[model samples]
Target chain A: MLEVRDLHAYYGKSHILQGVDLDVGEGEIVSLLGRNGVGRSTTLKAIIGEVPPEGSISFKGEEIAGRKSHVIARKGLGYVPENRDIFPTLTLRQNLILGQKSARAQGRWSIEDAFELFPNLRERADISAGVLSGGEQQMLTICRTMMGDPDLVMIDEPTEGLAPQIVERVGRLIEEIAARGVAILLVEQKLTIALHISARIYVMGHGRITFEGTPEDLRGNEQIRKEWLEV
Target chain B: MEVFVFSLFNGVLYGMLLFLLASGLTLIFSMMGVLNFAHASFFMLGAYFAYQISQPLGFWPALIAAPILVGVLGAAVERYALRPVHRFGHVAELLFTFGLAFVIEEVVQMIWGKVPVPYDVPPSLNVTAFAWQGLDYSVYRLFMLLISVGIFVALFFGLTRTRIGLIIRASLTHPHMVASLGHDVPKVFMWTFGVGCALAGVAGVIGGNVLGTEPGMAIQLGPIVFVVIVVGGLGSLGGALIASLLIGVLNNMAISYDFSLYPIFSLLGVEREAEGILADLVSLTTGAIAPLVPYLLLVLMLILRPRGLFGTRDV
Candidate 1:
């Protein structure tokens, strides 16, 4: 479980996140829905301590605000950065090893399990990550995080730039992860993707949360949806 | 043929020594992304500490103790000095190391005096170990070769075999990602910096006898070490090894064929006297163009291949 209470974050002088708040219960997939540059990514970054937020970020009831990004990651928080920043020079196997060995996460998805989840990864495990296609890279990034076996995983733009088929696969994968009893904070631009996988949704606009509800409750809520999601 | 064989033998030995210094620089620079100007200064301190301690504890103990002391000192510098400057940016970190070099050189002169300290090779290694092509190879030169090779082997093994080595290799390419995986990155960095300095200190112990122990040793060897790193590529140990051997062999070959190269200068109608500072300088730039050759190679490498021989990222 994770609780981000009235979190504020800035990039230099720009106050990118202003008094934002959200919560995700255990084994639940929560979606933070927002249009471009509305601070959805920043909120995820803040929770992971990459953005150095001011305010309370209690993950599994431990205060983690302003800690080093790596420190927060070690505290059972898995972050899939917006770009899926894979170590390009390393082999997929080596990258996965780094993930598995370093993070304080142990779970059902071992390296072998991860390889089974993404068969393409197993086939290309020995090759450099740089040479992989965009879809394969995304899969590796997601699987690499899963290899760490975190209790909660934050996926930033998992479907961004992905093909429709891969996007669908990622949606299914997210659902599978939630089913495995792990919480997820899905920051997504694609409403359909978020709606398909997430149990709860929050709409964000101008660095503030405007709506929070279940998929059906938010389905026809046109006013807040149009203001935040339509664009 | 006999003189050539001797030169070749000496060349390999000297090259291995250069490799020791360059390897440390390459590791620290490539991994940390900071060209530690104080690296050679640490080398200088190693010589001074050896000279001071050798007076009381004898040469063998000084050789063993000096590098360990330097490693501890290096760890201290990383924790207290480099870590703070790292927050400011790369340029500030560079300038900080540059200042550190100056302070170290000044400190050496203040403590050891302006003159070169008489740090002799141990009597145990004073005699000739072998006669190669009728040239007597001193036991000290053989010792230097053994120590250099030993360090290289140990370093290579330590990097490839140990868990810490694996972490360091991963961090070298993806420092942030490594930290994200939950290892204490700063601690790894501190240890790396310490190891790098320790290697430099070991080089100083051996190199002091080869080139004389002095306050001037740091400045004398500093720029060439830079050349070694630039030519070797930013962070690749393989590249560093190749570059070090290349520079070392080239320097020796240059000495033997100095007059042959001079004729080419005459063919261009460009005499050394016309070339301003090149005609008149004693600071490793003029009379023995051997030392300057590595830097020239480095500049050319930068122009043609900035990523270095095997670097994955920009230099």
Candidate 2:
């Protein structure tokens, strides 16, 4: 379980995450939806301790807001950045190896499971990650975090630039992740995938949460979608 | 032929020494993105430490102990001095290291005095390894060559084969991502700095006797190391090797030849009595300009190929 309360973050003097609050129950899929530059990414960044957080954030009943990124990570939190920051010079397998909290520990997932989930990664396991296409890189980044075997993983825009069929595959993978009982806090711009996958959805506007409800409740609210989500 | 053979061996020996220093410098730069001005100071420290340790325990123990001691000092410096300055941005970091070089030099002088210490090759290794023509190569020089080559092989494998090595390569490009993956990146940095310094220390232990263990030794060898990395291409281990050997062999050949530009000038139909700068240039012998070879190569590389020979990214 994760609980965020009154979170505030800043870049220079301009406040990005202004007094935000959200939650994700154990094994639940929660999507944070917003337009560009509305602090969706910053919210995830603050929760993970990459950006300096001003409020309390509790992961599985322990406060983790101001801790260092690696410490928070060892506490079983994983983050996949929006840019898919794969170590371009490293091999695909090396990228996965780095994701593991410890090399010896057995986790819920294995490199084999990652390969099974997507066979393409196995085909190019020895090659450097730089040569991977955008879709393959997205899969690698997600699977890289999965190798850490975190109780909860925060993914920012996993399908932002992906092709349509790859987007469908990513959707299936998200479902597979939740099926394994790992909580996901997904930051997304596309409402269709969010509506299809998320158990609960929180729509954000101007650095604050404007709406929070189940997928059915969001689908019926045309006014909320028009004002906050629709371009 | 004898001159050529002797110069070739001497050049390779010197090149290996340069590689020992350049490899560490390249690793630290690639990992931390800090152009450590005090790297040569670490080399200087290694020699000084080896000299002091050898005074009591002899060269063999000094060779082992000196690098470990310098490594601990390097780690401590990273933790206390460099880490604090890191938050203030790269210029601050650069100035800090730049100042660190002067401080290290002053400290060495205060303790060791301004003069070169009597750090001699061990008596056991003082005998000639072999003789070619009239030139005899000492066992100590061969020993230096062996140690340098051994370190290179070890370093190469250590980086490419080990898990920690894998982590280091990742951190070089994605420090934040590596941290979020649960690696203690700062600790990685501290150790990286330590290991890099330890390498310089190894060079110091072997090189002190050969190069002379003086306070000014760091300053004297500092610029050439920069030339090496820049010409090799910044942050490339393979590039560093090629650049070091290129500069080393070129310098040795220049020094051995003792030829002047006068013949070329005559062939170009220049007046024999060419005035001022032209006369000065014509009269300059290769041996006299040997010291300037690396710098000249560095300038040429920057002008023609700024990214370096094996660099993946631009310098």
Candidate 3:
């Protein structure tokens, strides 16, 4: 479970995330839906301690706001950034190995499990990650984060720039992650996938959550979709 | 034939030493993106530490201890001094290291005086290993060669085969992503700086006596090490090795052969009756201008291929 209250973040003098409140219960897949730049990504970053957060962020109980990124990560919070930040020079296998918190400890997910999920990674295990296609790299990033076996993962736009088929695969991967009892806070652009996968959806606008409801509640609300989510 | 063999051996010896220093410099450069100006200063410190330790303990123990000391110092510098200045950007980091180099040189002068210390090779390794065409090669030189080669092999395997090595290589490109993966990236950086300095220390331990342990030694070899990395390619270790050997052999061959450009020019049907700078240039022996070969290579490499021999990234 994760709890965030009045989270505020900034980029120099310009304010980015202002008084944003959200939550993700245990084993739940929650989607943060918003058009272009409503501070959805910054909300995830603030929670992960990448950009310094002003308000309280309690994950599974303890306060994690403004802690060092690595410390926050070790406390069972995993972050997959928007850019698909795979170690380009390193081999795919090496990238996964580097993701492990400790090489000695066996986590919920093993390298084999990841490879089984995406057989393409296993086939190109020895090749450098840079040569991987956009979709493969996206899969690698998610699998790499899963190697750490985090209790809660905040993925920022995993489907961005990916093909429709790959986007569907990524959507299934999120469901698979949740099936293993790992909580997910997804920052998604595609409405169909978000509406289908997320148990609870929070629509954001201007660094604040404007709507929170179930899929049916969101599908029924025409005004909230037009005002906040529509381009 | 004898001259060629001897020159080749000496060139390789020198090349290996250069690699020892350059490998560390390249590792630190690739990881931190700071072209540590104090790198050769760490090399200098290694020699001084070895000399100081060897005086009281012995050469063998000093060989182990000196590099460790220098490595610790390097880690501390990264944590306390460099890390704070890092936020201010690369210019601040460069200036800090540049000033640190001068400060280290002054400190060495103060402690050991303005003269070179008598850090001779250990007695066991002083004798000749073999003789070829009446030319005798010392065992110490061979020992230095072996040590450097061994370290290179170990370093190669360590980087490619180990888990921490994987983390380090990853950190070289994605420091923040690595941290978010539950890794202590700052600690990785500290250890990387320490290991790099320790490598320079190892070079100093072996190379000190041969090159002479003195205050000006760092200044003497600093530029050449930079040349090695730049010529090899900025972040590529394989490039550093190739560039080191190339420069090393080129310099040694130039020194060994006193041949002038007159013969080549005459062969090309150009007369050597020029005046002023042209006359001097035509008459100059390769041996006389041996020192400028690496710089010339650097200039040429920059002009022709800025990315370097094996580098994927541009300098």
- Number of the top-ranking candidate, with TM-score as the measure: 2
Q: How do the candidates rank by TM-score, highest first? A: 2, 3, 1
Task: Pick the winner on DockQ between candidates 1 and 3.
Answer: 3
Summarize candidate 2's per-residue lDDT along A1-231 as a digit string, tens digits. Answer: 899999999998999988999999999999999899999999998988889999899998999999999999999999999999999988999899988988797799999999999998999999999999999999999999999999999999999988999999999998999999999999999889999999999999988999999999999999999999999
Worst 10 residues of 3 chain B by lDDT: B262-271
Q: By DockQ thresholds, what CAPRI class is model 1?
A: acceptable
What order do candidates take by DockQ, descending?
Answer: 3, 2, 1
Q: For candidate 3, give the lDDT of residue B106.
A: 98
Task: Give the 10-residue window scoring lowest on summed lDDT in candidate 1 chain A.
Answer: A99-108
Docking class of 3: high
Residue B199 deviation, candidate 3, in Å? 0.6
Residue B240 shift from truth in candidate 3, angstroms: 1.1
Give me the displacement of residue A93 in model 1, in angstroms: 1.6
> Candidate 1: what lDDT?
0.83
lDDT of each: 0.83, 0.92, 0.92
| Model 2 agreement with the true structure over B104-221: per-residue lDDT tens digits | 9999999999999999999999999898777899999999999999999998888888889888889898999999999999999999899889989999999999989999999988
> What's the DockQ for every one of the candidates?
0.44, 0.86, 0.87
Which candidate number has the best DockQ?
Answer: 3
